[model samples]
Target: MKIERTQTGVRMEKRLLKVLKALAEHQDRTLGDLLEGIVLHAFEGRAAFGDETLQVIRQLKAVYGLELTARDSHRLEEAGDDR
Candidate 1:
């Protein structure tokens, strides 16, 4: 097997770590590769959550009796609409 190495560290909750490990194993990827992809995606300014995602978050907030700021509401509305 080829060995790839990099120096980096990120702290995640233990439960999140377990889930990541399981997903990596299921996909036949090393944890490092899985994490690298995620980091790269975020660095590339990809939306980790899109329209449906924002809707879900808004729904959850509503269910918990939370209110969004005007800016947040505008952002969510923008996210919902196709540009």
Candidate 2:
């Protein structure tokens, strides 16, 4: 099925967006396409990706300097006030 998509702006961490863009290019897909797939899978109570994709994600995570651990799941304040 073809779904129409609308362009929208969203605020996100700069490095995170960089990683997502790289991942999209690595997978030969668009950022919107990848995010839609991930979100839809989550809504269905399923893993968004399999082992292979996870590996690719890990590589991208490392390249993007994202050293997130299982215990890092929590809200983090900005490093410093930009203003």
Best by TM-score: 2
Writing each residue's lDDT as its tens digit, candidate 2 over 3-80 gives 899999987666678888998898999999999998999899999888998898888888889875546546544679
> What is candidate 2's TM-score against the reference?
0.81
Q: Which stretches of candidate 2 lie over 4 Å from their true place?
A: 69-74, 79-83
Across 1-83, the per-residue lDDT of candidate 1 in tens digits comes to 58788787876444446655665665588998878777877899886455774575465555544554536644543335576
- Candidate 1: C-alpha RMSD after superposition: 11.9
Candidate 1, pairs of clashing residues: none
lDDT of each: 0.62, 0.83
Query: In candidate 1, what residue range of length 10 has the lowest lDDT sum?
Result: 70-79
**CA deviation > 4 Å runs, candidate 1:** 1-4, 7-10, 47-83
